[model samples]
Structure formats: structure tokens, C-alpha cells
Target chain A: MGDRAKSLRNTIVLIAGLLVFWQLMYAVIGEVAMRSPWQTMRYTVTLVETDFFWVHLTNTLQAFAVALVLSVVLGLLIGFALGLHRLSAEAMEPMLVALYSIPKITLYPIILLAFGLGMSAKIAFGAIHGIIPVALFTLNAVRSTKPILVKTGRVLKLSPPAMVRSILFPAAVPEIFTGLRVGFSLTLIGTVLGEMFAAQHGLGYLLMNAIGLYNVDVIMSVTFLLVVFAAGVNGILLAVDRRLHFRV
Target chain B: MRRVRLYQVGVIAGLLLLLEALCLAGVIDKITMPPPHRIAVDLVKLLLAGKLYPEIGKSLANVLLAFGLAYSTGIVTGTVLHGYRTARETLDPLFATYYAIPVFAFYPLFIVIFGLGDGPQVLIGFLLGVVAVIVTMLNGLDRVPRVLRKTASICRMGPFETAVHVTLPFCAPYLLTAAKLALAYAFIGVIGSEFIMARSGMGYEIGYAYTNFDNATMYPLIVLILLLSIVMNGVLTHWEKLLLARRGQR
Candidate 1:
């Protein structure tokens, strides 16, 4: 309870510090380039109520949902396949790490070329950004499962799939959850990035459009919305993540 | 290890051959991608022509600048913050959630304030990288043996001497890891911002070539960026392994 209270206090202090920083920056940069925190909050409230904002929000959410599902499923399949085979894992892990570190935004052109300009392209881009981390984490997690458990599974003469289901997956759950949390964030970033370029609708498109009009209010409010959503979801996942790690 | 390398080479070669075959068979149209070999040839031709050197140079310089700034500042800040437990704890949540928050969302606001120049791009790169470096630094510091500090105290070494001779050397592998991350993030942040709204850079050139449907230019540029990043990462990874292996030997 004391630890929880300390953490809660820390979080509150962090948020307050950030708000103060924002207000300080707003003062320095002035009204021309940025909106104050209070103004941004007010505008965000108004922005959330608008029908136009909902259209973009819905589009983004839909793309993000499909992309996330695809990423997790495909990432897990790849992870499990490679993890189960020592030779394949040895050969592929470095390549995956290299792929992960690349500036995938450069690949946006190729993705656009293949998927064309719309929802599918955005989903593909997001999934591409997301899949690597999930696969990498899951691969490590599954590989590191307790040797005794695997020996026990072998003693039972369990089939490969059954062994994985009964032993590996459960053991790897915490680390896999960490990957999913990271994947979630990267997928959101990728989806928004895809929309920023040559898209008719989405928060990213709205951002670009507002920039063209030099609309400080819209930019701040939208940026604020994105940060708030990303940070809030991440904070919740982080709490769960810590709990899972502590359990293990 | 040799067998693993062979398998990796085989896998990459097989994929490229498959892509080449698909392009040759017209199963994948020319518009989508112009075969891997063609991309290679174009890359060579583009390099030989030297038409885009300025943009490439500018982008590379910015990446290095961002990386240098992030790495130096991050190390210093991390070292300082290590002594301030309360501050570090208060900042923990921010560090935890930092990457999750898209740094690019602020690009528009940056453009507004900095007016769409190199400042925003470099700033974005620095922002993306510095936290990673700081986190890595903190992690490295946490593992430093108390015996080492006691030895420094016994020797009557000052803080600077202690850091220079002891802690920093102990943290070499972590510093390399931080360097790798900082460089990668710098590459991503700069190239990405350039892709979005820059007037000139390798990313902007790719965007330009794409809009004009200049597949020759676009494909080559994309291939160039990929090769550069992969090579840089490979070198850093190799160096990091060497450091780790040496440490293990001791």
C-alpha cells in the first residue's frame, strides 16, 4: 500500500511537472505558435465533440484495430515457428533486430506502392512497424521457458503443439504482454504516419491540413489528443506489465 | 556460427531471387517494384551520377549532429540524474511512456515555431534518441560494482578521475548499445521528418521521385537508405559483440 501510494504520488507529480513545462513553453513561444495548456484543453474538449473529428477518429481507430490484430497474430506465428527451431532462431534473430532498427518510414514508399493509398496501406504500414518487436520479444520469451517444464512435457509424450500450448505460452505470457504493449504503440505511430502522407482522412491528415492553414489551435489540440491517448493507454499497460513482471 | 551465416545468406538470396523471378514473370508489375537487380543497378548509377550527393550529405550530417547531441547530452544528464533519486523517480513514468508517444505529432508545431528548417528535423532526432541513451546509461550505472567505487575512494580519485578511469570503462558496452540506438533513432527521426515536410534531403528526394513516378530514382534511393542503415547497424552490432566478448574473457 505504501509503495502504491508512492507510485501514485510520483505519477501525479510527473503530470503536474509536464503541465507546468507546457505552460512555460507556451509562454516562451507565445500565442502565435502554440496554445496554452488551458486553451489546448478547452479546444480539445470542443474538438472531441465535433462530428468531423469523429470521422477521422473512427477511421484511425478502425485502421489501428485491424493492423494490431494482424500484427499480433502474424508476429506470434513467426515468433513461435522460429523459437521452436534452434537453427532458424539462430539465423534469423539478428536479421529481425536489424529490420527493427531500420527507419521504416523509408519503406513507406514501397508499402504505398504495394497496398495503394487508403486504409489497407495504412494497416499494412502499421503492421509492419508493429510485428518485429512482438516477434523478437516472443521469440526470446519462448526460448527461455524453463527447461524442467519442457522436460516434463517430453516425459508426458505430449505433441509439439500441445507442449507449446500447455507449457511455453503460459511461461512466456509476461514477456509477450510487454511485446504487445510495445507493438500497440508502434502500430499507432505507424498508422498515424501513414495517414500523414497522401491520405484523405484521419487525425494525421487533419494535422497536415491544419498545418497548411497554420491553425495553431487544431495542431495543439490534435497533438494533445494523440499524446494523451498514447500516454494513457501506455500507462495502463505499464501498470499491468509491472504486475506481471512482479508475479514472475 | 558459420552454418548459421550460410543459412542467413541462403535465406536472403532466395528471397531476392524469388522477387527477381516474380518481376521477370510479370507476376508483380514493374510499377510496383522494378526487380532487385534493377534497383542495384540504379543504385550504382545514381551514386556514379552524384546528382543527389548534396541531399545525401545534408541528411547524413543532420543524423550525425542529432546523434552527437543526443549521446553527449544524454550521458551527462544520465550521470547527473543518477545522483538525484527523487528526480529520477519522478521522471520514471515519462521515460516509461516516452517512445509510445509519437514524437512526430509535434512536427507540425515545430514547423510553426522553427519554420520547417533543419532545426525541427534535428530536434526531432535528438528527442527520439536522447531518452534511449539516458535510459541505457542509467541501466549501466545501476550495475557498477560498489567495490570499484570503494577502490576509487581508497585511491583518493576525484569524481572526474573515478568516472574516466572506472565507471565509464565499466559501462563501455552499454555506451556502445546506447550509441547504436541513438544513431538508429537519429536516422529515423531525421529521415522521417524530411519525408513528411522537408524541402530537401534524401527522404525528400525519395518523396519527389515517388510523386514524379521516377522509379529509377525512388527505388535506388530507398535501397540506398536500407543498405546504409543495415550496414551501420551490422557494424555496431559486431563492435558491441567484440566488447562483450572481451569483457566476458576478463
Candidate 2:
């Protein structure tokens, strides 16, 4: 059989295996703390219908949207500025990477103090978390563009701005999209962590609030919602990436 | 490169000096940020008086242990996934998607199951870190050219022999890269769990200071965290450079 067909079959089998494992764990524990896969799935559907859940979900989404746009705009500008010059790019790359790798979540306390317990704190935290990776990736994307491509643009007597729009931007779009995916994920994590640490509303706040009440169902359901949402968004991003990442 | 290096150092020093000047002139709030000189002095005192050692030890121990666990499990899982081409294709999407999801929400669930303290802490750290290692290993192993498999058969080598002689050596550098990234994530995971709740750890100490609004202690702790991150990053860069130099020689 071809690899693709075999792989799809394997995926179905793996999903079945995961389900069995979840059920087995639930059986062994038989505790509310460890809900069955079926239970969490059912609870997830019910949670989606509630007004309270919607409010928190909206808050999380809003933070994500703001952070995503801010990070992308800032990342492109900074990345291009640095990436165009070899000296600046090499000197700054390490710092950018260090900042990106370390959990900026550690800086949350300072952010909370500065921005208060409002949505602003979450937005700032999420933006910072997302910005570094996007900027670093964009820098890399720009730096790695083919020299031949740029030479061809010059040969055609294209203006610098036109060169960027046609040659540089298109050549780097694939990597920029990779950065976007990473930024999206980090932004989600930042927003959730911010809400958990200090926020009146959001999925993270709800998760923590549920913990205080020892509401196991809510915790599992919330987690389920987060996973589904992340997977859905990632799938869309992946599709977009594949379409834009043309092989030259 | 040398000039750029000097420029970078100078820029960082200039920024620090500016911050020090502002704090010295009382331009910045003392409560929000103590002067750099004072923070340095206080940090030395905390280290000398043995106030922060136990917390550092606890956090370090958790990170190392969790990283060890992650390294082993991540390697095994990656190997298994890669061993079956179909499995590799199937699981790749799930793992990639999960790279973004907040695994922290499960901390409470872990607390309920493991009864808090170090068990849940280490487990959470392992979860956070293992993904990086697994993905690296899978990619590395996948990149081992198919020619090696053909060569192995020509030489009458068994599966074990082929893996050890061809596949393992080929991916050694990638494995090292994975180790570096895994350690970084392990520390982040360990510290994060500590921040949330821990009997003793750097993270727990930071959490304590923040809750009490103890700026005196918080600033120094943050400085310590920054130092730790810089040191880890330096080690990884040095190791990678050494590896590349050694490879160039061969």
C-alpha cells in the first residue's frame, strides 16, 4: 500500500488506542478527578452553551486577536530592519533567541503590577510572549532569502520598495507564516497564564475558579475546549502555510 | 563579528547605567524598583546568608530530575514513532498542535491525583519539556538517508546494528540540540510549577514575594532567574560551537 493510505489507517488506530487508554485510566482511578474521555466530551458540549463560558471565551479570544496583530506588525518591521544588515542580525540574534526560549511567563508578576488586573495586563503579557518568536523567525526568513533572487530583482531595475514587495516578501512568506503559528500558540499560552494569575474573566480564570470550587467537571471541560480550539486554529494556519509556502 | 560583539556589550552596559542613574535620582519609584546597586547588594546578601540556596537547590533538583525523565521518555517515544512510518505521520499533527496549548490547566488535576508537592511538579515539567525532545528526535531520525538502510542490508547488518552504527551517529548532533532545548523547557516547567504552588523552590519564593508585595525580595529573585537563563543559554551556545568545530575537523 502507498504511504498516505497506511498513515491514515495508523492514525485511526492510534486514536482508538488513546480512547482505550483514557478509559482504562478512568477505570483504575474511578475518581471524579480523572474523568473518562466520554464524560469530558459530554461536559464540553454543555459548557459551550453557558453564558458564563461565552464571556470568558470571548475575553481570551480578544486578548489573542490583539496580541496576534501587534506581534505580527512589530515583528515584520523589526525583523526586516535587523535582517537586512548582517552585523545587526548576528549581534541581536542571540538575545532575541534567549528571550524567545525562556518562559517570559516569569515576568508576569511585574506585568500584573504594571498593568493591574485588567485585560490590559493579559494583552501585554500575551503580546510580549508572542512578539519575540515572530520577530526572530521573520529575521531568519529575511536573512535566508536567495541572493540570486535579489540579484535578479536588481537586474530587472526594480525599485527598492518594489523589490521588497515582489522578491523579498514572497521568498520569506513561508517562514513568516511559521512564525505566525508559533506566535499564535505563545499568545494563547500567555493569555491563559495571565488570566490564571490575575484576571476577572477568561478561560484561564474560569479554570482556576473551578479549581477553587473543586469542580472537576468544569476543569476537564475547559481543558477540552482549549484543546479543540487550539487544534482547529492550528489546522487553519497549517492549511494557509501550505498554500503560501510555494516551492521555487 | 568582533566589532559587533563589542557594540552589543556596550549597548547593554549603557542601558544598565541609565537605569541605575534613574533609580539613583529617585526618578523611578523605590517600591516598584529599587536601585540596581541596592539590588546587587541585596542579592549578594541573600546568597551569602544562604537565604536563597535551599530554594535554588529545590528548583534545580526538580529541573534536572524532570529533564532526565523527559530525555529518556522523549527518546523512546520518538524512536517508536519513527520506527513505524505510518505512526510518525499520524502522531505528528497532534504533537505539533499541542506545542501551543496551555498544559498548565492540568496542574490542578495533577495535584488531585498525585497529592501536590514534587510528584506533580516533576510530572508537569516533564510534560512541558518532552515535546521538544520528541520532535527533534523524530525529525533527526527521519533525516537519516534511506541509503544507510540499503547499505546495512548489503553488509548483512541487523536492525540493531544498523541503528547503532548508522542512524544513531547520524542524529547525534540533533540529539544534543534536543538536549539543550529540553533542559531549557524543563527549567521553565519546573519554575512555572513552583510559581503556581510548591513547598519550596525559587518559583515558590518568587510567588511568596509577589503575594506579599515584597519588592525588596522580588527584584533580586527576578535578577537571579535572569542570571540562570543567561548561564543556560551560554552553555548551549558554547556546546553547539564546540560541536560544529569538532565536526569541521572531521
Candidate 3:
């Protein structure tokens, strides 16, 4: 108990030290760059309070949300189809991996041309980038599903849907969750990239505008918000993962 | 199995051919989505002009330099953090916080600090690549077998000797894995930076073409970037395999 307490105290001290170091570095560099920590904080707060900030935030979030949903739905369907059959899995696995390895960013122009420069374009781009990981992960998860469980379900004379629900889905939950996390990260990247390429609104557009104007403070503030948002989303996923782990 | 593999390739090829056909048929508008032949011609022109090679060189240099900086810093920091568990616990969350932060979103800040040159691009690339390495190295260090450490200690190995012989070798596979992921992240970071603010890299070329509505030129640059990414990923994977084999001998 004493050792644990001592360790905890040491960890706290280390965190404090890091925070101090960060602040010191910011202070030293901030004056030269005109981007002090205090200034960034002030800007961040003021920006958040503005209605203009929320409009851009909402646009980006809406596109992101739609992309994520589409990717998840399409990914799982394709993954299941590939995973359920041995021949399909063997044939498609290499191609899937190759496609995943390709920088999907190159397809942005093609997507933009197909879908136009609206929200559809961004969503389609995001979906394309985000879906590959999900499919790959789901395929792996389903391939790893236990034969014993399948046999047991067969012995019970379960229906096809019942077998999937009780055996396959449950068994694949952990790996699917892993894929979902990766998919979420990729979705964020895709959405931002889409916005950067050609967009009239969103945080990506805002950041681009800030760059065009050379407004470092606004850029920094937007970046800070994105980081915080990503962290928050991650935290939520982690909490859910933990809860599911415990329940399972 | 072979037939299925062929089918998969055929499908992808078919998709590409369909797009080409559509452009040829004037259904998709050739100006907006040029046929594959036009893209190929543009690619040849870019290559013949000796413009493509220099852009590739510049992008490669930026990626490699930034990756090297990130790898060295990550390894050293990871080692130190791993040696002190309390320190690792404290720093881990902080690193995660930074990692979660979209490093690209700070392009403006980076441009302000390092100017609109290669310095800022490399800085952004390093920031994206380093965090993953640090996390992977730390995880690898934590999972190092206690028996190996005990054996080294029994041999009267000093701290530096033990780290050199035991810790680093034990962490080799993890470091390699991290390096692979870091390469991908670094590539994206550099390309994204160039896309947003660069004037010379392949990304800048793509951005320029898009703005000018030069679909033929843009397609070739996009293909070049994609090819670069694929070739780099293959090289790194092959290198990782070789290193893993060498480590297996021990």
C-alpha cells in the first residue's frame, strides 16, 4: 500500500513537471511567434462562444457522422459476405489489403467529380477511406470465429440468423470494436482531407482560410478544438469498450 | 483460388475501364474526368520534362528526414520513460492527448514558427510520426520478458550494457512495427502539409492542377503520389521482415 501510494505521488509530480515544461516552452516561444498560451486560451474561448464557430463545427460534424454511418453499414455487409465463404475470402483478401494500402486520397478528384462539390462529395470520400479498415478488421474477426461454437450451434439446430446473433456476432465483437476505433480515426482524417481539398464550410475550410490569411491564432485554436473533440470521442469509445468487456 | 484472384483483379480493372469508357463516350465529360490514355500521356510528359523526379526527390527527402528525427527521439524518450514506471504513467496520457490532437490542424502555427518552407513541413511530419513510435516502444519495453532482464542482471551487466544488449533487441519487432505505422503517418502528414501550403512537392502540383481544372495533369500527380505511397509501404514491410528474421536468429 505504501509503495503504491509512493508511486502515485511520483506520477502526479511527473505530470505536474510536464505541464510546467509545456507552459515554459510556450511562454518562451509564444512571444516570438505572438502565440502565447494565454493568448491561445483567450482566442479559443472567444471563438467557441461565437455562432460562426458552431456553424462550421456543425457542418464538419454532420458530414463526419454521415460518412461514419455509411462506412460502418457498407463495411459490415461486405465483410460478412467475404468472410462467410472460403473461396471469396481467399480470392479477395489480397486485393482488399492492396486497396487498403493505397493512399485513398488520390481518389478524391474522382469522387468530387462523381458527387459534385457538396456534402455528398465529402461524405463519399470519407466513406471510401474509412470503410477499408472496417472491412479488413471484420474479415479477420469473422475468420477467427471458433469452429466449435459453430458446431455447437448446429447441434442445437439453431436457425441461420440465430447462429449469427448468438455465436458469430458475439465472438467477433472485440475485433469489430477494434476496427470501429480505427474506422473512426480514418473517418476523421478523410472528412478533414475532403474539406481541405474543396469545401465552402467546416473546420477544415476554416483552417484553410486561416492559413490563407496567415492567422496563426485562429489556426491554433481550431486545431486545439479538433484535438479536444477527437480526445473526447476516443474517451467515449474507450468507456464503451470497457463496459462491453465487463458485460461480456 | 487462382481463378478467384484473377476475378478480383478483373473487377478492379473493369471498374477502371468503365470509367475510361464513360469519359470516351462523353457521358462523364472528358474535361472533368479525362480518359486513362490522356492521364498516361500527361504522366509521360511530366516524366520527360524531368519535373517528376525532382518532386519525388524533395518529397522523399522530407519524409525520410522527418521520420529519422521522430524515430530517434521516440526511441530515446520511450527508453527513459520505460525505465521509470511512474514517469511513463504520467507521460503516457500526455502523449495520448497530443496524439489525439490532429497535428495537421496546426499547419498555420507551424508555418508561423518555421516559415512556409520545408522546415514547417518536416516539423508537422515529425509531430505525426513520433507519437506512435513512442507509444509502441513503451508498450514493447513494458512487455520485455522479466527472465531476460534477470539473466542479464545475473551476468553482472551494467545499466548501459543491459539496455544495449537486452532492451533494444527485445524491443526490435515492436520498434519495426511502429516504424511501419510511422511511415504511413509521416507520408500523410507531409502530403497533407504540401497540399495545404506547399509550392513544390507532388501535393502542391496536385493542388495546382485542381485549382486550374487541369484534370489530365492532376490525375498523373495523384497517380504518382499513390505509387510513391505503395512503393514506400512495400519497402518498409520488406525491411521489417528482414530485421525480424535477423532478430529470430538470436
Question: Each prediction's TM-score against the native?
Answer: 0.99, 0.93, 0.87
> How does candidate 3 fare on TM-score?
0.87
lDDT of 3 at B122: 86
After TM-score superposition, the amount by which residue B52's alpha carbon in candidate 2 deviates from its true location, in angstroms, is 2.2
Which parts of model 1 have CA positions greater than 4 angstroms off? none
- lDDT winner between candidates 2 and 3: 2
The candidate scoring highest on lDDT is 1
Q: Candidate 3, chain A: TM-score?
A: 0.87
What overall lDDT goes with each candidate model? 0.94, 0.83, 0.79
- Per-residue lDDT of model 3, residues B83-105, tens digit only: 78766765654564454456677
Q: What is candidate 3's lDDT per residue for A1-248, written digit by digit as tens?
A: 68557645755686568557757868777755546556777999999999999999999999999999988999888887788787778777756766776657667777877888979999998899779888988888887788998899999999988987888889888888877877887788788778877899999889888878877778867876787688678756755665666675
Candidate 3, residue B18: how far the Cα is off, in Å = 4.0
TM-score rank, highest first? 1, 2, 3
Ranking by lDDT: 1, 2, 3
Per-residue lDDT tens digits for candidate 2, residues B39-71, read 888888888888788888988899899889999
Per-residue lDDT tens digits for candidate 1, residues B102-199, read 99999999999999899999999999999999999999999999999999999999999999999999999999999999999999999999999999
Query: Highest TM-score: which candidate?
Result: 1
